[model samples]
Target: MGKKSRKNVFTPEQLLSSLMDNIPDHIYFKDAQSRFIRTNRAQARFLGLAKPEDAIGKTDHDFFAHADEALADEQNILRSGKPLVGKIERVRYGKGPIVSVSTTKAPITDSTGKAIGIVGITRDINDRMLEEERLKSAQEELENTVRTIDMELNIARNIQESMLPERLDQIDEVKVAALYIPCSTIGGDLYDVIQIDEDRIALLILDVMGHGIPAALIAAMAKVSFTKHIARGLKPRTVLREVNDELIAHLKNERFLTVFLGIVDKARKEFVFARASHPPALLLRKRRRTVVRLSGKGIFIGFAPRYKYEEERVPLESGDIILLYTDGLVECRNKGGVFYGLKRLERLLLKHRDAPVDELVKRIREAHVEFMGDVPPSDDIAVLIATLE
Candidate 1:
């Protein structure tokens, strides 16, 4: 005898029944009027029925609060002969709690290819929908918080800029020009030129240890202290000592500041300057075509209490230029990791030695920008140029 065929182990009806009852998703068939012809165990339990047979001959209106919309969707599927796939729906069953479901409905066609009814499968998606809604709400709140912070930062930037001098006044026999750029909305670099007496003027530039809000606050405090000491007719060294004491008292060695202060006296035709761990000032002699580094020894402010600062005196002549700047100018790097060192800046000054103070400042800035190319400076930059007539 021939071996029994595997296909004969179960009839088609038995296989269909097994599949419909085993799956967890709701599966059902509806007639043209949208009344249920048959339902699986899952669908019957979903409709609060004790058995699948009890769901027969019942319409969705008997068990669903929004049955009219479901009926319209099924009727459209039966008429269009097209399948509706993966549609998310919110439904209430017999006044029970609402639920989210992903549903697919297809037209059940006859041998003639005419749609006679609709076959549908639905899966519960209530938990997934709730999670997505919660995530969306959180994202909106985060975006709102970011916007508020940005607005406040802009306001802070404006206030910091306002603290700087609008323009440096030209004292007797001296002309001045300055430029400032911050790596961010606010920075730790500051510069000021103040008239000390009829024949003397004070110039100051300072750099805090870092960038952003903390550094900027320190810079502001240093500025206020420097100005107060200068107003009392203190010498360059005395002014630095007072400012250092003030900073040490407040910061307690938590931060540091580099400062260069100069007093230009027309009567003596000399520039008296002091340093606090700052870069040396450059003096460009137009007639001799020489650049001199006015170096002095001092410790950084806020590092120690009562740190004594020393002064250096350099003679000034007609057509002489004094360049004061923060380290950010020389420390700026290019894409090749090459620094725009002091040698390059000295060469630039020599090249523009004959240019006016304002023109020279402009040229130096342009050269720095060109050297950077697409690279951005990592710190704040400030330059002050004083020319003697």
Candidate 2:
């Protein structure tokens, strides 16, 4: 009973004072007239005061006197009758920037419920505020990068679309349609149709050999160069020859172009085609499929100074149409990492040979979506199809 009484001897107020003295934060008390009354050990240590006895009657402003800091602090204590928490302010130490602190001051009340002195606690928060500011700046920078990228992609898409012939306009006895999808903001797929003469229609599908904006830019350049060459009266293979040399001179070691150029003569029912290390076009004749996988025997242009390409003529029947494409369509991968490869495409073409060209395109795209199983297409997919007589 005596030992228990000894433990209970310290009152709640005595325990609270012990807590204030031991805590790492600064704690102090001021009288009704804003005169220093009591201060804890923690308060003296924080203020660089040598001893708590020395700090008891000395106000912090008089002891730490850097400026009118004491007057401002006393004014704040007087205005807030209740506890005022988390007021941030900078206090100077020696040199450099004065770090900031979060301060709380509560009015002390006597037994009659009248306010007397004030109890104040202060916590330093300079590091946290600086870290928050750094994070905000990083977020702003990231947002700016995203906006710039979106703008560039929109500009590239507009330029690419403008280069396309407004409409294929049902050729004399030919039905043609094209589709191009870029997997990224910008990519390396191109397809176009040109009216060469009343009887001849020129068609081309080109793939710049890479990815991203650089690849897309190169494809646009090829469109300009190819169109200019043809307008100057150069033939398909001859234009390809000049393009090959020019591309080699322009592109660095890592880039090249795979292009298929063809002219269809409606009156003669003839097709003259040239392939430049490109994947061959697929000829869907009624119920049969032939992959002209044999591109002309030459290096992929831009890999060397000169590469020869040969042109071949084939008599296209009234019911036959050809499909030209980039590898992205067949090379698209699934969640299991399996490619929708050449074998799969060959089977689908044969099965869907009787369907309308647009239907075939739509269905194949849908099938690719299902096969990929929530994964995006990994590259650009470009397709061009023309029915000939």
Instruction: Encode model 1's per-residue lDDT on 259-334: one tens digit a residue.
Output: 9999888889999999999999999988999999988989999898887899889999999999999999999999
lDDT of 2 by residue, 27-62 (tens): 788887666677778777666667766666665556
Error of 1 at 316 (Å): 2.8
lDDT of each: 0.88, 0.75
| Model 2 lDDT, full chain set | 0.75
Using TM-score, give the best candidate's number: 1
- C-alpha RMSD in Å of predicted model 2 compared with the true structure: 3.9
**Candidate 2 vs. true structure, TM-score:** 0.81
- Candidate 1, lDDT over the whole model: 0.88
Model 1: what TM-score? 0.83
lDDT for residue 283 in candidate 2, whole number 0-100? 74
